[model samples]
Target chain A: MLRVKSPQDLGAGLLFIFIGCVGLYFGKDLTYGSARAMGPGFFPIWLSWIINFMGAVCLVRSVTLEGDPIATIPIRPILWVSVGVLLFGYLIEHVRLELALLTLAVVATQSRRQTDLTQKIVAGFAILFGIAIIATRVQTFAFLKPFGDAVFGVSQWICLALFAIYALLTWGERDARQTVILSVCMSIAAVTIFVVLLGQAMPTYTADYIAPVFSKIGSIFSSIRGR
Target chain B: MDFNVFSNLMTGFVAAGTFQNIGFAMLGCMVGTLIGVLPGIGPIPTLAMLLPITFGLDPLSSLIMMAGIYYGAQYGGSTTSILVNMPGESSSVVTCIDGHQMARRGRAGSALAIAALGSFFAGCVGTIFIAGFGPPLASFAQKFNSPDYFSLMVLGLVTAVILAQGSVLKAVTVIIIGLLFGLVGTDVNSGATRYTFGISSLWDGIDFLPMVIGMFGLVEIIRNLEQESIERNPISTKLRDLWPNRQELKEASPSVLRGTALGSLLGILPGGGAVLAAFAAYTVEKKVVRNPSFAFGKGAIQGVAGPEAANNAAAQTSFIPLLTLGLPSNPIMAIMMGAMMIQGIQPGSAVMTSNPDLFWGLVASMWIGNLMLVIINLPLIGMWVKLLQVPYRLLYPAIIMFCCIGVYSSNSEPSQLLIMVFFAAFGYILMRFGCEPAPMVLGFILGPLMEENLRRSMVLSRGDPMIFMQRPISATLLALTACVVLLIVLPSFRKTREVAFQE
Candidate 1:
């Protein structure tokens, strides 16, 4: 049995050979014209051959020379994070951007569980909201208008600020709950930036599902003013 | 000659000096410094992540902002190297040798200030170098035939392999793999698609964003998460300590001048960029500086000043080839080329003639961006150090969000995210096998262009293989490429390369 001395090189050699073979096999059907009149397949076929030759060289060196071993790959983070990313892609079109973000945060944090870490994120966000509120004096000004519509609606700021302040004071929680809740808050902020401020045309549950509740609240405010 | 250069620079100033453009430049520098100062991230991923936001701006402003990010990274990278002994950007790895030492001795302020000041001086020189050299080089490139272009790309790819760290065989194979990937979209001549694997998103060729973000951005996140927790303890410094004494400044000035000269020249080479320039400057300083404030690697101020200046200068000048010959000198510039193409502008000598404002405005903005970096890095640096305290758990999620949004917002294709995942996994495997991904990126950017030119040249020669030798320019570039390949195979050069990287 020929034992592989340099596992890393051996792995790389195998990978290159695999990639090269895939290129050749897939590119076999395309017309490879003469050198003077090259086809789309000519370059790829030639490249695949070069790669195969180099892989052969690497394979030879793997057994003949000493080299480092491949480091142990940690799978837990890669799995959760990749799943989170894929889920975001699948869910965003079907759900609100905010909910998709929530799903992402939960799945993404799976590898790093039991987070008893202290987070002043809500507090920091409240401070930022306070500054934005003071900047325009409640008269609607278009912020980041280069991107799209004016997102500096005064009513929206007041609501977000109040919510952030409330969250900051009330969420003296610990562990997984804190992680999920904080990420939810952060997700709300991200949705506001991407969907509202940036005016990206992504489908959102906010417009269809949540607008009715806001309108009802507006009606109540108007009725109170009339009285 | 000098007068024409001055007038061109003045036109650039007038074009880019608008309030809106300058504001965008400042914003770019700030954001760039913030991201670049983060550990395990470099300018390539930083540029890729920020690339989408620029799609909305006017061409000149977008290019200005990208330029700011490019060099702002150099500034931010040095700060990370000094305070944390971690190289935030690969170019700053040399700075960490003596810079962290200076920081440990509580002279972090001095080292930081020297890096900022030295980089500022070099930035000014590099901008002027571009103004003086750009037109001449572009005019010269006008004479290049298709065969010559093919040979030049061959030379560029060879040198990129030479410069990429680790096994030459691996880098070569990886570059070939990149070339294969690059040829995946439609075949322009035959009107047939190449290797779409039946995916509609790939008909126009693989989108640069998903590939870059996946390879550099997502892979970076995965790599970081592999460790249990990253330990970061940045050295704190007060505002008052942000100055070097006259003696230290005097010792550093000569080294700065030497490094600037070396960097401005090296950066114009086909494959040299900020990383190589920094490494070379450190080696040169050790040989040239007679009396250091301290010995080399012992918190020598000269050590910090020389490499810092060299890297900044190189970063500024590396844009020359991309802007002039339409050839990106390094992976960062390749990303820049991708951005320019996204803006519907092919980077080449034609850009200078057709869109002089865009070209010159970018040159002028390089200087303004440098000034912005000096200001952002100095007194406001305490904010950056505080940012270092943000735990990795909270930070990476936001990075992922940004990467996802960046990749998706550009094309609005869900398939792009899947592509990102694919490249991320691919990049992770490459990393584990000790093959650097940087060369592959360069090859990917050049592959299509190389094939197109090769076909054109072959047609011109009617399949005669000796056509390359017949053309003078092609002959010369091919000769240079052969020499580079020889250098890569030489035993003595290989030993020196290993020693250089080990440092």
Candidate 2:
């Protein structure tokens, strides 16, 4: 009897076979016309079969051939990062972009093992303050006020504040100084490129605030041209 | 073979040589080099992120810029492979072997110089090949019917299966899964939904940008996080030592020529591209350099030069299949195809005839981009090397955030972010099983085309199953596909295939 050599292959084969079967099930109702004119199901049915054959081959190989065994998966990082992404998706719609970003940054960084706890606690509250200030500034801008209004309601602020405290209690252990700096630089560059230079629409402070600054710059350029 | 090519090229140069086009090309090269210098970020994700930005520019300028990024990344990837022993992209994996060894032996400057020079030479020749061959090939492909196209796609998929590393069975499985993913949208023929699972967002199919970001960018972050903190002491070499000596130059010249020739030829094949070219060239160099002055692994300039040249040559010539046949041989080319479609320019034989300026201008810009890469990279080597010192913890979050923004910017849809998250987990699971995702991406891009052609050919044959056999070109392509499959399945060739990839 051939012994199973690689659990990785076995899992992968099973997954592929499962997906192929699922495809077959779903595509069952679609038309499978004759060779003269293929219906919607013709290509998919053949593809599913091919997938099943390949998966079966993989399954057979898993028992017959020697291969690399599955490594120990890091569940912690996967879970935290996934939750972080989901949280961003949830919050971006409800709480708007800036708060979503803050939440994402705090949650995602939790995946990393932190050595210093005290510094992290300090950074956590400081980051919250910075976020609040930015949120207020965004609300102050004319064009961005609506977006900011939807995000900074009383209940949302309370929820974010509570989450901030929870983050401080459970997750705020890693040094985020460098992360903060990089995020700031990235946001600035993104705004400049996508907004200023390209004239593309993006969620930022506002075009009202941006227009006067650009107009002044444009005037300087026009004056140079005149000269 | 004709002055028509010269006249067309002159038109291209006149269009592409303007200051604005040159500036965009330079910008692309600079950004591409930065992306390549950073580990864990490859060309696919970078291109996907840049796709949105292309909307604002004219098609020709955007294409010129994106093309610059493609080859420029190849050049920068080699630098990282040589300096840090970390390949910034898959195509640079072969470079880490002897290139890093050379760096360790205090020959970093010579290795870097030869890599740059060999790549530049190969790029020039590759561009010339495009200028000479692209038009005729397009004309030839324009004559192909549906059966021929279907057979060619089949050949392309088979080649992808063969060229992919690891188990052949797994590669095929991944490709099949990719095809199924492609089937998730509405069926054009019967107007029936295949596998939307009642999700409205999935009705139009999974967005390519989100999938690519999740698969390559987010999955890489997760994988990097799984590792112990990345702490490596990069080799410190002086800028003055960047020049290769006369003896080294003499040794690398023949290898560069050989690699250029090999890569240029291989790159035209359906599944062959820079990664395969680099791997094949290195193997050839190992065999051809009968008496090596230095050990192959320790510090051989030939090893660096040959693969470097081959990869750059492959990067350039890989455009031929996409430009002429409207077929992408690899994932990078597939992403390029996506960029073209986004610009409302359909890629294929018609591209040359309908948009000759765009075609020739992109070709001409490749040479300028190559020139800019050498000029930009050599002086900026120190900056890139310094960039390598940034902590992975800081870098990962930035990458993720950038990906999030890039995806959101593409369609301004929150659901796309969720789609990205889904694929991120899915990609991670697949990676754990040792399945390469590149083949899957290629399959996803080619799936609809394959189906369209298959159905069209069948309809033309009036239910005759023997249509593929009746068409000479289709029959030949099918025969070639069979040979490839046989070569993979046969025990002796399978071992050689494994050895080639493992090397």
Candidate 3:
């Protein structure tokens, strides 16, 4: 009896063999022209065979070699994280970016056991409001257009305010003061680098609302250059 | 030997020295170090996430920044390996053996300083090697015909199979699976769909960004989540004890030089780069320093210095194949090739002639980036240590958010997000089976090119299959591939290979 010493290798080998079989079956219909005049299927079918052969070799080796045993899978984290990501993908298309991000943060954080319910909920809401403010200022959400021209034309100062509130509520006093400070600095740096310096195509604010502020800054730079 | 090389490099410096380019380089170094400090987030996912952002910049600037991130991550990965005993990436795994031991003995600062200094020196040498060798290699590659290219690709794929850190059979199987996945779109010759299975998004082939994000980024998160908690050792807080003593420097200097030479040489070979170089350096250093002041694994500065130098050197020189022959020696270079194609620059010999500014500018920026990394990292050690202290619970969600946002923004298609989810599950399964993802990534990137070259060669030869063997270069390459395959198949060699990876 050939005992399977390496279950991981055995599983991988079987998977590869199955995939190769599937590839061969699917590629059957494509033309396999002569080697001199190769068709679409010529290269793929050959590769499939080679894969199948390699898989068989792996299967044989699994019976002979001793290796690390497979570890127990963490189903809870995998499920929660998968659902969280799927939800973001699903919601980003249908709902506003702010709502999608909020839902994602709440759902994804469920995977962790350390955080309290109150903190989780607070973090969720803070993410929701913070993103809404950031989106309003940064103009990332296309759906927000339906709110007319002057709907929540918050200044950049609101972004700073929302970040502070989010940081305080989410991070709390649990030795996360450094994280909070780092986050603030990173955001400021990102905004300056991506928006101010690089002049990325994404809108920083509503055209009519922030035009005067930028123009004023632009005039100051021009005057400095002229001097 | 060529004066044109020096003149071109100077031109490249002039182009790359702009304030904006330098700023981007600095930004890349900072971001790279930050992510590298974080466990489970390597350069692949970081680059995948930043792909969209780079799309907005010019090709030269984007490439320069990306290269900076790659090298900077290598530097940052060593920090965690030394201090926390947790290797942030595969290449840093060897560093942990002696590096963490040094940290436990309250010599964390010395280990970090030697690693940084060694890496900087290796990076400089590697850059100079590229500047000297890149042009002649490109010009030589320009003379290669279809059969030669096909043979070269065969050799490259074989090398990939050999270098993969597992059973050769399993690596080959994974690579084939990757090629099958690459065949999911319309065939260029017949315009017939291969494996789309009626999905509209499969019309243009699977997007590389989502696949990479799913495999490297999302899969890593799930794996990290499996652990109940990550155990982290406390780091020393003293800044004054950072520098190595005179005797320690004397011991480290020769090892660093040897490792650099080994890394630079190996980096040029197909499928041999930073990971292999680091391992080789460590193994050689073990033999070279027979009478170490301390035991081999107990706070040996040579161990820290040599591998760090080798890995950085290898990382820089790995650009040779991609820049010269349009062949990616590894997955990271494959991604770089993809980035180039996205920017409308076809990789290979033509790039040197067609876009001299882009080529030389990227090279010059690499040197600048290495300098910037040293300047940026030494002072920010405390901040990085603080970053490592952030709980996985909080850190992971932020990473996930970035991945989601990055994938979503890549094509602005909701369907791409679905693709990421599918590949994440697929990648998790692959991981469970002990199949490495690096070979698959290389296969996916090279599959189409391989097919194109094969067909072109066959057409040129008028249906003769022996054309590959008939050509001298092709025959030589095929022989080399056979030799490598034979070496792997031999039981004694296979054992040594497995033992090397196990360490």
Q: Local distance difference test, per candidate?
A: 0.83, 0.80, 0.79
- Give the per-residue lDDT of model 3 (tens digit) for B1-503: 24376788897899899999998899888888888888766666666656655667788989888887877777778898898888877789999999999998888988998999999999999988888889999988978998999889888878877678766777777877887787789999899898888788889999988888888888888888878588865585467887888988999999899999999998999988888999999999999998888777998988988999999899889999989898889888888887888788888988888888898899899899899988989878888889888778667766776777667766767678778888888888887788777678888888888899999999999989899999988899899989988988899988988898899
Docking class of 2: medium
Task: Give the worst 10-residue stretch by lDDT in candidate 3 chain A.
Answer: A148-157
Ranking by lDDT: 1, 2, 3
Cα lDDT, model 3, residue A82: 76
TM-scores for every predicted model:
0.89, 0.90, 0.87
lDDT of 2 by residue, B329-349 (tens): 888888888788778888999
Query: Residue B367 of model 3: what lDDT?
Result: 90
- Chain A TM-score per model, please list them: 0.65, 0.64, 0.55
Candidate number that wins on TM-score, 2 or 3: 2
Report clash pairs, candidate 1: A96-A205
Candidate 1 lDDT by residue in tens digits, B308-354: 99998998899899999998888898899989988999998889888
Worst 10 residues of 1 chain B by lDDT: B1-10
Q: CA lDDT of B147 in candidate 3?
A: 92
lDDT score, candidate 1, position B39: 81
Give the winner by TM-score: 2
